[model samples]
Structures are given as structure tokens and as C-alpha cells.
Target: MKAMILAAGLGTRLRPLTLDRPKPLVDVHGRPLIEYNLLLLRRYGIVDVIINLHHQGDALRAALGSGDTLGVRIVYSPEDPLLDTGGAIKNAASLLGDDDFLVLNGDTIIDLPLDALLAAHRARRAAATLVLRHDPEQQRYGLVEIDGEERIRRFLGRPAEVETALVPYMFAGVHVLSSRVLDYMPDPGTTFSITRATYPAMLAADEGLYGFPFAGFWRVIDTAADLARANAILEERPPLHFL
Candidate 1:
């Protein structure tokens, strides 16, 4: 299996900290944030990794060149004018090849049963399976509504209307995507969001887009406070099995 860490963001929210490095390179308890995701994928035996680079990208490359220290073989996709999620995936289509690959946010920490998520994705034969979790701030983060069968009835605000009594969940920024999804994406080099543009189109066409329910430790290290909170939480009791 292959994986891509969406690490190209300028991370405007992180401010001065990100002024020196990319969001994924920001320190979290003495370790770069992206290192956790790299180690997490390595733990699950997914070693082939692709990282899209933009802001302070050279620094990221300098810090973890070739991914040898991290136990993963990484290739970088350098984007001068950064591509959004969907565009990033499309940009690295050649590296990802023709298989189901994992996509995750570089600035977040999440610990869940990856095997179970993969099993569910295959069982459902979904075109894509996003990791969804209940968050009181679902609307704040963005609402990802799912039906009884776990089909994502709506993503963010896409498909604006739905009669079904959909349950809202927050997108964990992790997902398994089939190679065929590339068909639904814009032309290569185009900037677009997978959730905002691609997924909704797939949903409209009745393509299977499902959600994997996750109830585990998850945090988005976006702001300075978020970074601090993660460190505090981890310091109290190391819950991450990989650590």
C-alpha cells in the first residue's frame, strides 16, 4: 500500500512558528509534527510515502531526506503555487500508481485501528472512505454527514440539501482512496478540493463514497494552542501505541 501526507500548506494559522518552517515541521514535544504521521504509516507497514512540498519545503527535505531515518521511502512533489488536496493527489498520480492509497493531513495526530479501516473500505468497495469522528465542533470544523450505511450524504456544505436524517461527523483528514477517483478530479495541475469538488461529484453520480467511524485519540495541530494541548495530553500518559 502507498500513502501521501498533505504537507504543503503555508499554515497561516500557526503564524510565527510556521514563519520558520512548514506546519508539518513545527515542533511538537521535540519531534517534528510530520514525523508522527511518517512513523504511524510505518507502523502499519505502509512505507511508500509521497509528501507535497511548498512553504519552507527545502527545510522539510533537509530534516527528513529520503525518509531513511523514518523507515519510509519518500518522494516529494514540489509545488510552487501550492495545490489543494485534490490537486496534490492528482499531481502525484504517477507516484501513487494504480492502487488504493492512504491520504492524511501532515499537521494532525490520530491513532486508530488502520487495519479495521482498510477492511471496511474493501468490504464496502467504496471509491473513497474518509475517517469520520464525532466532534462537538463538527460544524465549526466542517460537517460531514453520513447515513445509516455510513455513506457520506454530504461533505462540508456540499450537496447543500438532503432529506435523510443524516448524522454529522467531523472529517479526520484521513482517508483511503481508489485510484479510479482520479477520474473525478480536475485535470492535473489544477487546484481543487477533493471533498468540496471531487467527492460531491462522485456522490451525485452515485459512486460509493463512505465514511469509516473512528472513536480514538485525534488532534489537529493547527494553532499554537493545539500544539501545546497535544504535548500536555501526551505527557500525562503516552497513549500512542507507535510511540
Candidate 2:
């Protein structure tokens, strides 16, 4: 399996902590935030990885050179002007090759059965399978609606109106995407968002978009409080089983 870590964000939410380093490089329990994702990918036996870089790109590069220490072959796609999720993936289309690949947010720490997620994606033959979780603050993160069959029906808050009062599920910042979904993305070199643009289009077209609900440990460290909480969690439970 192959994976891509979306680490190109400017980390504006993290402010002072990110001023010296990228959000992915922010220290969490004495380990870089991105390290948790890398280790998880390694745990799943996905050794080929690409990381998109922007703010503090050099520091990230210096922090994890070639992914050798982590037992993964790492390549970088540095965007001059940071491209959002859609554009970043399109920019690395060639490197990702013509197969399904995993996408993980650098700021998130999650421990779930990735193998099962892959199995479900293959079984459904979905073009894009998002890992969803029931977050109480769904509105804060934006919601995704899924049907009985787990097909993604809509991206809440989009321009389109959803007739049904569908329950909202938060995107877990993890995705298993088939290469063909890249076609739904805007032209390469253009800044775009997968949620606001590509995903809505895919749902409209009835493409094979699905969701896998996960009830496990997942945290996104976007603010100082989040960072502190993560550190506290690690302090209470040193050496997370996932890592």
C-alpha cells in the first residue's frame, strides 16, 4: 500500500507553536506530530509515502530525511504557494501512480484498523472512501452525510440542499482514494478543496463515494489546547499502542 501525508498547511491555527516549525513538526509528547502518522502508516506495512510541503518545509525535510529512519521511502512535493487538499493530490498524481492510495492529515493522530478500512473500500469498489467518526462537534468541522449503504450522500453546508435530515458525521481526515477520483479534481496547479469542490461534485454524479465509521482514538491538534491535551494523553498513557 502507498500513502500521502498532507503536511503543506500554513498552520495558522497553531500560531506561535507553528511559527518556528510546521504544524506537522509540532512537538506532541516529545515526538513530532507527523511522526505518529508515519509510524501508523509503517505499522500498516505501507512503506512508500509522499509528503506535500509548504510552510517551514525545510524544517520538515530536515526532520525526516528520506524516511529512512522510519523504514519508509519518502518523497516530497513542495508547493511554491501551498495548494489545498485537491490541488496537492493532483500535483503529486504522477508520483502516486495509478492505484488506490491512502491520505492522512499530518495534524491528526488516529489509531484504527486501517486494514479493515482497506478491505471495506475494496469490497465496495468505492472511488473514494472516507473514514468517518461521530464527533459531537460535527458542525465545527463540517459534516458528511452517508446513506444506509455507507455511500456518501452529501457534504453538509454546501450550496446544494439536502432533502432529508441526514445525521452528520465528521471526516476523520483519513481517506482511501482510487486514482480515478483524481479526474474529479480541478486542473492541476489550481488551488482547490476536496470537501468544498471535488467531493460535492462526486456525490452529485453518484460516483462511488463511501464512508467508514470509526469508533476509536482520533485527535487533531490544531490549537494550543489540543496540543496540551494530546501531551496530557501521552503522559497518562506513555507509548500509545498505536505507535
Deviation from native of the Cα of residue 232 in model 1, angstroms: 1.1
Error of 1 at 222 (Å): 1.1
The 10-residue segment of model 2 with minimum total lDDT is 157-166
lDDT of 2 by residue, 80-165 (tens): 89789889999999899998999998899998788999999999999999999887655557578888999988887533244457
Each model's C-alpha lDDT?
Answer: 0.88, 0.88
- Residues 1-243, candidate 1, lDDT per residue (tens digit)? 999999999999899899998889888877889988998899989999999999999999999999998889999999878889999999999999999999998988988778889999999999999998887555546468888899987776533333446567878899999999999987889999888899989999999999898988888987888889989987886658876
Query: Model 2: what TM-score?
Result: 0.95
lDDT of 1 at 70: 80
